[model samples]
Target chain A: MAVPATRHDHPPSRRAAESARRAAGRSLRLGFLLACAIFFGLPVTWLLLAATKTQTSIFSDHPLSVGSFGNIAQGWSNLLTFNDGELVGWIWNSLYYAGSSVVIAVFLSVPAGYALAKYDFAGRKALLVLTLIGMIIPTAALVLPLYLQMNALGLLGTPASVILPLAFYPFAVYLCYVYCTTSLPDSLLEAARVDGASEATLFFRIVLPLSKPVIGMIFFFSFVHAWTNFFLPFVMLSDDRTFNLQVGLMMLLQSTDAINAEGGFSALPIHQPEAALAALVAVAPVLVAFVFAQRYLTASDVSGAEKG
Target chain B: MTDTETAGRRPARADRQGRRPASGAESTVEPPSKRRRRLAPYFFVAPYALFLVGFGIAPALYGLYTSLFTDSLGAGTEFAPLGNWGEVLTDYRLVDSARNVATYVALWLPSMLMLIFAIALVLHARPGRFAAAMRFVYYIPGAITGSAAALLWLFMVSPQVSPFSPLLDLLGVENATEAVSANTPLILALMGIAIHAGGWILIVYAALAALPRDVLEAAVIDGASSWQVAMRVKLPMVSRYAALILIATFAAGTQVFVEPTVLATGVPGQISSTWSINQLAYYYATQQGDFGKAAALSLALLLVGLVVALLVIYRTKFYRIDRGLS
Candidate 1:
């Protein structure tokens, strides 16, 4: 079957043209891919390199070069001792906020999603619409109302103000809804019901077990959103002690004069290097999480694509 | 028939038997009243309904109410009755912000479409180990915190220490700090966000993947080039996905707060507290303590979001579901 095609093949010019087309296609793909990699990858590389340099060296030396170990050690020390050990406090605050919010968001959203997906009920359509609206309505638009609501309850400057608002994950609910409805067949649930399994038991034992892919996706998404959330925390929490990693970095960037006043050994102010280092610290967890759970997320994308 | 098939058939027979009067052991269960059965679905949806009322519906209604009146930065509330809307329409700052946002949308929407389509095309054309690796790397930044991304861009765009400073110099751009002024900063901010968001457009790419391969093969046989195929056949097929992306991008674009607020450092006096609608609302409520106006601005944004949401849902056929079991 394969050999017959060679005898029937076209003349040299046509074959050459086809080969040229294939080659051009491959080169285009590679060129564009390389360009995109550089476009997205350059900033990250800059951050890594800048984190190693001192403030003076950042400007004076080649921006892309790896600096000496002495400079990196000094940068680390500056990050640690910046604002008299506040960086550590901010890291703790971020972990507490993002970690708790992720747990609560997943907890609330999963069951709610299961309920919506498995049970046919009144207002199910309405709830789905509301959730869609909630997902689309950028959180920034609602920040004012949320802040006012928090202020009325005198919850401003408190962690509850941030965590409570972030916990309301409409998008997670949507994700879980999609996952459960499509992936978890009803016959399995019907069989479990016949075996005298209660709704709660079924959910925990069967539904939750089968939902690992989506749960991981939801957790990663919620964690990243909560972790990187700055506007809400910035507006709600005035106390620097309560600032999350993102807000902490913002404050560090803003405090350029104060860092200069610290009278470091170098001529340059430590703000830029410190800012880069702080940003790296903030994004580190998300990068780690992405590496681990990315296959699941991409799988979800593939499934969604097939569905679409 | 096998025992399992007989067992499955037995349930249908039993169901029919139970329906007949006094014919089976299963008939003893109480038949629920129609009203009670109807109400059960509502009970399942009650939590979300209540949440919508309190968190979603009420605040939005209150915002519409508040926009009608003028509350003088917390001094006192006075009934302005169309006054605030007039001010929103007439105020210079608000007008400038609107114009700025329009310019931003124009610049951002096109760049995002071009870049996302280009990247997605590349990924689709070559589906292998490298494609997977490329997708993961591009998406990693998006998974990071938005604020961190913004902060990262601050260093990247700053002339004093940016690795891209040499590239900027090569482009004959002077003073990286000045390059991020109000007029130019929005584009830079959009580029930062675009870099962060390339991973998301993979959804559209996924949609593109679902387009029949035979269609492309046919196009190729018919002498259509790759570019021609992408533009003519592929794009038209994925119009719905593209529409979804456009609506989503527009809705999210209006809420541009973090990027501008962070980049505000480079451009002083040009970037205001109320650069975007959300920021306007924030300034009114937090800085000025004017809840009423803030509410008004939020309501406006909510309306825009609602329209966009409805458009996406309607266009995407998101509501339609077919259960093969039924």
Candidate 2:
């Protein structure tokens, strides 16, 4: 509770002490807020400026200084001409990979999470444990194994190589399990069941609609996971044509004229500002998605869902 | 899935304190011949189970098997059972990578928690449009992909183009590489990680939001200082959420790849390049063409991540059937 400023009875010294303490706390908070603004706000803002700067100005200009719209245009055009619009293709590939994986994960994870949470089945604990294990395992650990498997199946470098591995989002499944168990009242499902609704019908018609927010939340996360992923696609696809934005960015970074080990710029097409532009390109969709999902994913999204 | 079976059963689980106590929620009576009910769950679980087999279990098994064979990165595998694992255990780069990661966790795991915790506390301390707007601004970067964020931070850390260049220059930072020096890339990479702190601030804020209004008011009436309320009352009240963030964030640190990889991209030698475990594994898988070693290193990271997560789960009883971990 906010303290009322009525110090009607306090001694003058004590009142001064209380006000001093209150003022100190206020400054401490303000200081923290300012620190946060710098820590959190500085880099993205810098990147925004970097995106607008000309390639040469990237080295010459002050880091945070505003640049021309011409620089933004040039950065983009440079990115386009780099390997003949290769970065744009990577952007498309990332959308496809992330989009498809989200689709598969949402459809499958919801049902599976429902099953694990709602049903009392043999081996359910084992299933939960399996999901937990899968959920906790690092993506790095899975890359080599999946690479070998894909290679064995002769699917390496294909879209499936990345999409399939990314599709198994045990974390989302666990989230769904938690959602269904904690938030979805068993009564709602039972009512559907009592009405002679088939399991498929109940899930498709009832559970799916009821769980739209969680689904959106899951889709948003799954898309982020796939879209931002570097290692899986790094190992799975060798072809430059199939690369996601992260991998493509890496490739561009390596070839960027700014970072070339030798003195003068290399014959490589990509450069510092163009790479920055490509990076912005990759992050654009995610920003859009976050905007759309912001309402669905308020602080109370998972935990607060139950309150509603 | 068995959305049908437990469609109405909270029996033993209905009493925990949360948004809704399970006690009053109507649970369905189990029909007889629920013996057949066991089979129903398998149907719902099949999709996840299938994916687990294809993507999780199978790949992990294959990784283990691959780790037993050296030079498997190439077309041919030369079976040297445990040879790669031995190398992984004794490699100098492994030690360096571990130290780098440990240093990073020490820096990152805490800073991430504390920084976000502080913001979370501040925002929760005052609820208004300003806090909400700040929360939105903070989380917008959460949507920025890791590599993109890294690239963005690369700009900030780069003294040449950074807006904070004057401040960084005043601190003796001459270039991005110097900013994320070989010895201490932790700070540089953290900026990239910190940009995503907005969502977590909201998360911790939400956890704080769950604190009962009367309890806080009672503390205030007791003449508890604002600092005491924050430290003694609010902090303890939200410790569970803080712990969750702590454990999850630490687990995530083990997988830190993009920031380091992107920052170290054309740097000569192992300055910031070989500073993380994933980088080591990535070098093996991609550069060195040693899938066996990569697989071994990946397993090491996986083991560490899993252990941390499991420890948190155990400590928090997050998986307890009743009294769901907030």
Interface RMSD (Å), every candidate: 6.8, 4.9
Backbone clash tally for model 1? 1
lDDT, candidates in the order shown:
0.65, 0.69
B271: Cα error in model 1, Å: 3.4
Q: Which segments of candidate 2 are over 4 A away from where they belong?
A: A1-31, A114-120, A152-154, A177-213, A258-270, A298-308, B1-40, B70-81, B124-129, B140-151, B175-177, B182-185, B202-244, B270-272, B323-326
Can you write out model 1's per-residue Cα lDDT over B1-326, one digit (the tens) per residue?
33234323422234234343332224455544323433544554455455555556555556667778786656677888777777665656676677666777677767777778778777876666787678766775565444445556656666666777776666565664566762464544456454546545545455555454534655655555678878887776665456556656777677666667645544444467777667777776778776666666666776776787777778766544423111
Each prediction's DockQ against the real complex: 0.31, 0.40
Give the alpha carbon lDDT tens digit for every residue of A166-259 in model 1: 8777767776765555455555555565566666677778777667667776787788778878777988999888898778866665555322
Candidate 1 vs. true structure, TM-score: 0.77
Q: How well is candidate 1 docked (DockQ)?
A: 0.31
- Candidate 1 C-alpha RMSD relative to the actual structure: 7.8
Give each model a TM-score. 0.77, 0.79
**Which candidate should be chosen as best, given lDDT against the real structure?**
2
